[model samples]
Target: MNGSVFSSCLEASLQGQAILNDNGEFLFVNRAFCEHVGYTKEELLLLSIESFVIYEANEDLMKKEPIIKRGMQQKQVEKLILHGNGYLQTTLFTVTDVSDLNQGYYHVQLDKIVTTFDDVDFSMLESKLRDRDEVRLPKKILDGIKDTIITIRLDGQFLYANEAAEKLFNRSMEELLSNDFWTYLKQNNDEELLSKFYQLLAGEEYTQFEVYKKDQDEWFDVRAYRSDDQVTLYFINISNRKKMEKELKESEMNYRSLVEKSPETISVHNGKEIIYINPAGKKLFGIRSFSEGALNLSEIVVAQDQARMRENYRMLLTGKKEMTNSVYTLKRLDGKKFDAEATTTLITFKGKPAFRTILKDLSERKKVDDLIRKSDKLSVVAQLAAGVAHEIRNPLTTVKGFLQLFQKEQEVKPFYLSLVMEELERVEAIIYEYLTLAKPNVESVFSKIDIQVLLEQILTLTKAQSNMNNVTLEFEYEQVPAIYGLEKQLKQVFINLLRNAIEALTDKGTIHVRILKHPDNQVCIQVEDNGCGIPSERIDRLGEPFYSTKEKGTGLGLMVCYKIIEHHNGVLNIYSEAGKGTTLEVILPASN
Candidate 1:
């Protein structure tokens, strides 16, 4: 080959190589080298090698005088240079003598071995150089990261720790590096974590584990990635999330305990399918265990109520209505019926839509209510007896007087006449009671009655009794709707209530009667007395027949009053506090 051909081949091979004289000035560089460093051929020739040493590493390179002396004597040297964009690069050069005796001229040949001219493109070479520069970059970048990053050796010793790691562990990087990484763990004695760490050191690529930080005494989730011989651990504090989970578990447990302990039957269901049931529910349904599919809500609910239950479910699912509290009649497993009050709510169970219901058995309450009803009936019967007595006593008195006058002759047998009069008086009293019970002519005289006037008349009639007891009578009447009823029957009711109030008062006690219209447009007559009130236990029995507190009370008085009020389509409500007072309120619907 010709000399020109050889020169061209050599020059092409040195395209990315560069050389610099011992004076720190670039003497020659191939086209590829000039472009890789982001400089033109002329610019490379003018530039000094030290200019590309990177400002920070320049002093270190200057201190190494042996490297410069060796390169000058041997005519070959290898050194790292900083590119224009602050990157380090490795370069090899072959230098020639350029002393003054040689007429200020020099010749040199250079090459790049690690990054060859053909293999190293300008962009790729720059990128590789940048990566090398980054290896020596300061750790300030890690300070801005939120997550804690730590590097540990195979011996469980911390090699490096970032600012976040320092804050989280409450230790300085120097302190962390000096201590064993396990020593900073709150539960350093935990065998499980140690085992996991052992597994991690045994070449396990990625592993997740929980460790407690001693500084905060809180748990953290650590995800580790192992590369080469070092392990990189990323830590995230999840204490708050764990605490919330614990609280939710406790709340659920408390709710379950309440359901299990309650006397009322309770069950949770999704529509007609039962998802969960309490012990009470099982007992109420006569089920041995809820595990049996037969004990589901669909099976327990009566056929008649099924449709209604489905409708309610539809309403709840569609968001048109919410689960409501309601009273419903349920059929028991034995085919008997019972009343229940159910409170329902929408809930998510096991990540699926569901409804929970709490049921309360109302059987005992119903029984008590029935007893009250019976007592009311007896009260009415007693009122009728009193009314009969009032109507028949007058005729009985006339008969007795006439018989006494007839017996005045003394000619007839005195014993027989006396016996006949006695029997006649007894028969007349019985007839009087019968008349009262019949309530004859009471309802027949229906008329619009002013409650205010009626109350006043009753008060007038009881004035003598009030005076005997030294009780003061007071009246508070408001303009109210008139009530249609038998005036005489109503009068009797008012009299009975007023008399009871007056009798209860001690000396100087007050009796107050109030007349007003209720919210339902009904007349309300309230007679209150400041006297010794009945005990709570005895109040329920007040309207029953033959139940009385007074020694002379026949128990028929209040009963008679209750009957008359009922006949007039009214209700009597009584309120009393022991040693305080008693109040009676009579409510009658307004006349059309």
Candidate 2:
């Protein structure tokens, strides 16, 4: 062929074309080829292919010499050629066998790197994938591509869609084909993008831009190219990457702001040396200046914690751990010891591994906690004193009066002596009960006791309070079997239950206390009330000490009751509804 005529015709061709001699010197270049190389035809013809073709830096010349030779499939490589404008363009080279004439024509492809697929058997792959009845090479090619590929007509109507495109749009081909492609996008103000999209059907101008899916909250990097009757769009789902970049930039700003203004002492250390300390950290540690080597980590950490801090420092450097929190007695610059809560995290500062520490002073908090504990102990002691005096005073008076009667009478009858002994025993029992309440370590001598007598005594004690509140109390019980338990502790438990029952009634209400012999040789007692009931949620936390719903009430009352019942191996089950009343059931093992 004539060189000028062939070059002119190749200039108008869509594919980039070049002719080279056996020496790899360019003889003829087309306009498309020159544009692909970013050079003029005259300038391109003066250069040799080996000089213009880019090999890796410090690459061996002998290894790259066989690329342009006649029959080397090794020539099928991603040739990143240097453009005239100092840019490296990814181009692929395929040569014909005209090297016999000392010249060959090479087809140069730009815009994509396809050398990776040169070894793949596309014919076998297509045979398995294609239907026997349909000739659909374009569909197979479009489907084979990893990127989301979609084709649209000049009017933006869908022509063909691939699996990736269906996934990105979250729709099937039938759903996507029913709508215009532009319906999934909003109008953007970029004139350059608008112009490229308008010229997409002409196969002349190729463009790439980013747009978001109107239906999905995702950003897609789109590259549009025109083929025979349709415009093909290659979509890369860059939503996560784009979102991460945006979030990283925002996090940088937010982290800088938080670190600068945080109240906690924040400092950075690289192994043994202090790199950066915020204003709060510097003030807390009494650091006056930032000399690069003046702040040593060992000087600030107390001697006991220095070894631990060193171990954690090594872990951060090796990336075995990222963050740690601990309490330490740290030293200030003046050598004063103060308790500090330190949180250290691994971070990269100045592109090097470093540890960031945030410290909070525990001095004031520790002092407040100590004071609150002391106050709580004093309050418990005062409540104990009041309860002892109020509970035992009447019994002491009854015993004193009976002793005076016996002293006034010269000769006392045996019945009179028995009366005095009974009153004296009641006073002694009250003393023993208070002592057991104080120290639960007292020895328990379990005996068979009348469960009915225990209930009657507790009701009689709370009778005055019940009458004062206009609360009626009723009971139902058979002469049940004797219960094996400590009499004083059981009495105290009943007293507490009855007192709480009386208080539950706001106005006039009835409390039904029942004692029954269960079928399994267990004695069961039910204290049912028609008064203000406990809420369902707080039922679990009812026996917790110091957790009370009443004003000026210590939750110790119910807790003590539960402790006594548990000592007897009893189950105290409480059932309550908010508007309705409460039912407290005590089930205990009966004696033989």
Candidate 3:
């Protein structure tokens, strides 16, 4: 046969099977091939078989060479063809020898055309047919696919869904197709998402998005790809990932709030430098934003406390100490100082080693501590005063006795005797004031004393002095509970407070005293004055012996008053403000 006749015969015999050249350009295709791919014979010749397959499946077509080589060597190749309408078709090809006839001077014709389907069994034939049919059938392919696949129109209308998709959405394919795809998704009703969906229908492709199914009410991660006029989506449930992210955010917020509102100053330091500081720490350090290496721990601490702070930091860094809670003085940037109790611990912050310290301000506590020490010193002074007064009393008595004897003998002049007597009286007064500083016997002599009456008696004695000082004294008394105490001591306590009040008042100032019963069945006597009041700074030291503001003042008056009132099981409270006034309140338990 001629070459054209052989080519036509070979093409007509294979039915739907085709042939291709070495470059994969179609050489010839039979009528069956044209009908299977929805192309005419003339058109099929112009288009390569590779163009009919999907773009992603083009690689599979290129793999046909190896099979063709094997077939040429073994004489046959059975292959699957990808249909233009998105399917695979199995076909068989048989190679033949069509070598030219050229023997030096002339040509040697060794033409051969062979065809065989005898080796193809019925089962193999059936598999080929099935592969062809199944290629165009998505349901069959979807059932075999591992990932869940769903097809939707441009309007997000479900068209086709796989078994995995059906199971994940907890809905049948019919149900999914009946409703809008976004209706089942979480937050689909949100205005922003609804607008986005409209935009998606308007030719926008949503790549990887988060969606939720209506039936199961669960979330998924969806990846959508556009093909033709439809969108193919692949979904993966990511509820666990979403939940973890939410929990992490909440935990971070809680920790941040705790650090911000803590009463103590909190700071996070990387090595020797501060990285983060809380509000209290910022105020304590007198600066903001202490970034890396900006300020060292020693620089912020007071000079006297630097050694202790350094030691604590060293121990923390070396792991010799797990945590530290120590008190030290912290200096402000402005040079003001405050006592601080700092607690420190090692921590890792943002991939770097760091320490977190909490510092509590102890300035008010230090003031109280100083007062306690001063009070202790005053107690010693009181004891010394008592001893000196006792020692000097004997000498004063002997001197008075000798002066009187000399005056009677007429050896001493009258004026000298009078001067000696005046000196002796002054010495005696000093002894009396010193004796009041001695510790009082607290054992109560159980005698019911009308507190109002005792207060009136002391007030009458001080009225004459108040008039001399141009101070008006007023007293208010109510029927109050009586207390059992030494009458003489109680009177002395009243006199001492009254004298202090009178001295504190300027000319024409008023002194007010009120005696009443407290809610706890205790007797309360309050002495208030309108005078140049004590300063807050000096008020705490008012009761210490020998610590006086007045130059000629003994300062033992309030101290002795404190001792006497304490012996009577009473509490003394002094409230004063500079330029305001002063109030002294004494509370004593009532007798049963």
Candidate 4:
């Protein structure tokens, strides 16, 4: 390398470097060395080495140490020094005593700072131990161990044995020495142990396992390690520990069975943090897998009950209270809330105190409560509609007839006339819906109706309505034989369903109508829409009279559809998810 390049490399080196004379005074210094002490190159030479040294082993900075010059490699030492900002820095000092480093000056190098002791080559230390023959374990140390310790070879020749090994083999040391260790075996003479011994000698690694004792009816955990040229085997009796582990496993199985079989949801929590939840506990929280469940109890707790739940948790965790049962509303992962009665009891778990909670879901009871309230609302609306429906219809008809007459006249502004006609028709439809609810009168027009032909007609009727709302109507049909039903009634059922689907759409979407027939003479009609879906809780109320998701909906249209389908001996089912879509399936029996 060029001389200038070598000097530049030395200046840019991360290791701090400095050239010192025999007196350890700085003769020259690199940029890193200058930076190490927060001083420039010119100022560094003016300062003595003793100025940076926080602690020195030799005390005399100028004294020549034998280890520094005699060792060919760099000698590392625990060196602490003061930094540029007056703070102490721990560093690994690598000193090279070069006789002619630069004009006969010595080089002092400071490597990176590490919070560890000085680095020493461990291989060289190990080489010295390996240089000698076997270093025997003393008899005093050998007799003190409770484990059976033996020094053996690949050929099973015993070199040494401890007192425990002697008692185990039932032989004196004089008789056991130089004998094949396997010859004294009463139980374990399998090739598995022999293969392992050969592998050990082949320098695989140290291994430990459990084996049965032949001379004694017991199990021992065996440890095999190579020390120098010999392999040492240590066997410790573990029969009692093994028996205890088996009993513990049996007890755990029983505990697991009880937790799984219990009908009530059971969970254990340490304070507000949930530690364990059983299978039934997951279902009680309206979850199939608890992996996505909240790790803390507060997540599933309703906002209104969170503070009370926390208070109850705190009370149960401490000795202040032993038991508490409170009715709370629990929210599921899908944001559905259900009523639950939670019972908490303080108990010892895993050697520490914890709270055990049992939850009984009250969703069925909530539905019954809602039914009672909805029935009262329906009764009030029905009586009022029946009292006024007859008195208003005669005058509403006269007003609609006059609007229709003006809507056709050339002198009248057609736009205003059409607006009046639209409002009058809306009023007429609501009156008709209320009258139908008061007394449903469907004309019994039974015929062998082809569902495919009926759906095609229904689609044509709703296509314009769907297009006006920017929604597409998609129809797929698989033809089949006709069935006996009220054709006009079925047509009415589909019109209401398809129109409701189109109105549910918020943006450009599709309404799919599929008609298929089964081999068992049954026809299936399906209406699927890519619109706002009903929530899980409100799905059951979809076809109920006087209930609707739409703003101005009377809910009577769906109830009439249900009634029309019921008269045809057909079944209706709705499956939906919030914001996804809704699928309605109608399966009716086919006829010859």
User: What TM-score would each prediction reach against the true structure?
Assistant: 0.41, 0.29, 0.38, 0.38
TM-score of 4: 0.38
Supply the TM-score for candidate 3.
Answer: 0.38
Tell me the tens digit of each residue's lDDT in model 3 across 1-592. 6879866875675355556654334567767666655567776566544443322233453444533221243245444545443334444545432223531111111122232234547444433432342332344445566567887666566766777877876788667767766776543444433554564567766666777555466678867777666677787777788888889999999998999888778888864677888877887778855565677766776544554465566668877568988787777888787778889999999997888888888887879988987879988677886856755666577677767888789697677667667757767655676766654564655689988888878887888999999999888888887788899888888887888788878889999999876644677789999888888788779887667766546576778888887666566778787899999888787776
lDDT of 1 by residue, 310-383 (tens): 54565578784576665667876787777788787788988988888888888888899889979798886777
lDDT of 2 by residue, 1-592 (tens): 7867766787777767777766666777777778766778887676666555555545675665543666643245456554554334567776653554544544333434333333547444223322231222335334666679876766767766777887877788778777777665434333544566875655565778887765577788889877555577888888999989999999998998898788888888786888877788888888887776579877887655654465555556666557766677888999998999888888878897778888899999999989997979888788777776755676667767777877887667788678778767766765664555567535778999889988988888888889999999998997688988899888878777877877887889889999987654678899999888999789879877556767645466677777787667666768888878888888777776
Please give the ranking of all candidate structures by TM-score, highest first, separated by commas: 1, 3, 4, 2
Count residue pairs with overlapping backbones in model 1. 7
Clashing pairs in 2: none
lDDT of 3 at 294: 77
Worst 10 residues of 2 by lDDT: 128-137
Question: Model 1: runs farther than 4 Å from truth?
Answer: 1-142, 157-159, 178-192, 291-294, 318-337, 348-353, 378-592
lDDT against the true structure, per candidate, is 0.68, 0.71, 0.68, 0.71
Candidate 1 structure lDDT = 0.68
Off by over 4 Å in 2: 1-438
